[model samples]
Target: MNYIDNDPRLQTGKPAGIDKISIWIHPFLIREPSAFHPSSGNNKKVILRYTSRNGFSIDFQAEFFDPFKNIFIQILEYLIGLSIRGILKSPINKDFSTVEKCFCTLFTDLFAIDCIEFYFDFMRGHLILSNITNQKYKTTRYSNNYTREGKSVIIAYDRIERLKYVNQMNYDEISSIIYPMRFEFKLNRTNCEYLHPTNIFGNYNVIFDNYLIFLAKRWRMYNQQVVSIPVLNNLYYAEKFKTIIQYSQWQFPYSMMNLEKTPSCPMPNKSVKLKDIDRNWAVQFSLKDWV
Candidate 1:
């Protein structure tokens, strides 16, 4: 399988100006020397074939011998699970979510590691750049009162204040304060798997989930006008809450706005033609009726 070095700097953990490196994974079948032995047949093997832009190539194979067998098998499984087909088929410039899912699944499911935390750490620099760009866009796109960055910052600040007040601690001490709270909640779980933080990965999972819930709650609180009402109860708010629910997964969309135009007047009591009604109002009414 071919693996291009689109991000070679990631491998060295440093920014280097180099052309793309070509990578290939091939089966390194080895035939036994003994002809009479039952295990004389070719043994299964795998090797990584790396080729630089200058045509310099190197082949490396893992020692799948006794002591390293288990760890090497896990690593191989992870590499295989990151579908080679997807990588080849994907466009040169891929979306963040696609890359995130591929790497997260490769690390989390195959290696039993907390890839999301690693992902956050890996993207911290990019995120800082993104925030700066987004702030500039917000400044240019909207008025002071309607600036998304201002609103988001205020909401975040308020959440931090509430956390400090409720936990009786400073902002820096919030993690220590919330750890016990999270532990108590996890203890309530009936499943033995979650009863204790058996390993670092397990503990990280708990921390990550709790952190997501905390952020979700803060977001919901900030956008109470859109989230307080049921997703089914209002079409306007449902559309607005879709992105929020995607991030949080704490709310459900029981009903959705009807983008399709009604053929006839759905409401009998109201002597209003479907076409005559305002588009937003008509959609909302139709959605309620459909639900």
Candidate 2:
């Protein structure tokens, strides 16, 4: 076997763009989440009403407006645009090595996160610039020779927060402020080989489950990951914690509002007639139920 081929580390990790990963994550994460949250009002519509940090209530809408605003997308646009524009006024793209250095430095400076976690997507000969911040994500192909049009959708989330629970605001409650914000990307499916087993913590298994529980109890989670709840199509990750006001996960359609038509019905059957409409009747059923 070839020397490079024989190495297991080489097999597990790709060498291309391994040196310049920070450039990738800084833009993609912000763009994708922006599309999901559009504007302040939209986030509120998506998220349930709740108070946090000094009587400030942020549904999905407010969270998108205030905090999760610019960390990634705007910065990426600036750097990439500078690269294309050859704008000497900007510090980046003075030289190839300096450009790479600028990307890494700027990325770490803005996100306060590590550069190694991002994976660069290469299609044909170009890099795919979607969902770069998410460590675990999938990519699809488009067109172009030097640049391949690619899209990425986030499968999971790794968020760092200051509260014992997610999105809670008690500055006095905060104890330690860790630098370079700690997080790992959540894959739609888990594979043991990629990460050290103990690193994952959550309701599902990956590696950091226990640590997540510890954080859940000790730190207030300022960061959040809202995705489609696997079992409940109409539900989101925050809707699940209905009983726990401090941190809510997996927001269901009914949880957000009381309505006649169930929030997430496959579509709607015009032929089917309804009488009294209550959310209780539409409890989310798992995939196994249909199977």
Candidate 3:
């Protein structure tokens, strides 16, 4: 995946293209008093709040690779394969392009899927998706008026049965069924700097190089997990694992200095394993040091 030069034709905040997807870090994640904590379960509860002023929005024009889209497709296909093989019974007939469109609709109609708004549990080494809600509004300047709109829903990651049913339905039905739940959680009011980990400033090449290394490490760790898609209930196989590894490496090359060796993972199986990174080797060395 070579980086595409900025196109003047792209409107101010539109996605770069099919190849690019941006991840936004939530303001809460980097705040001085971070809402996230390793110990407290309540603190860890993920809540996505949308208001008229700032409905959930993630800017991806800066970073082009679409990890969310890639991972979503991988999981969707894996689920479909399971259904076809008799492990599960879900109707999945759509091609990659159709499924991709469905995913975009999910973001636009129901909830935002940008990296920033969601909580990334770094300590646990998995991404977490939780309940999402729309904020109610009240205005009292001229006259007392109150209005509440938008839907809320809790996506239970542990409930594979519910997800299976969802995968079987069309986009409209899925949206209608999943978009409404009560918004009950409290919002974090603390202010903080929004630093998307991948968007660190400096030389463009250096930042991209470091970002790729970070993504590779994270993806490898994610691939090694027993449950597929971590917080989401889906199963993955050897072939799909290979596809993920290849896709990540292809999108972000670890090194331009040397092309002799690249990141590699073992075949995906019941007992699949990830190779350890060698700090001493140029190929495995962290780009952070040089950057």
Could you estimate the TM-score for every candidate? 0.15, 0.18, 0.20
lDDT for model 2? 0.25
TM-score of 3: 0.20
lDDT tens readout by residue for model 3, 96-123: 4533443333222212233321111111
lDDT per residue, candidate 1, 65-132, as tens digits? 12112322333333433333232222133454543444333222112211111111111111111122
Which predicted model would earn the best lDDT?
A: 3
The better candidate by TM-score, 1 or 2, is 2
- lDDT (tens digit, per residue) of candidate 2 on 1-291: 222223354332222111111121222112222232223333132231212211111121111211112323433444444444443122323444544444444332212211212221121212222333433222222111111222121122221232343455455534432211222222211111122111211111111222223222211222222222223222222221212223234333322321112112111221222232222211332212210
Candidate 1 residue spans exceeding 4 A from truth: 1-204, 223-244, 247-291
Q: How far off is residue 135 in model 2, in Å?
A: 39
Highest TM-score: give the candidate number.
3
- Error of model 3, residue 263, in angstroms: 28
Over 4 Å off, model 3: 1-172, 175-210, 226-244, 247-291
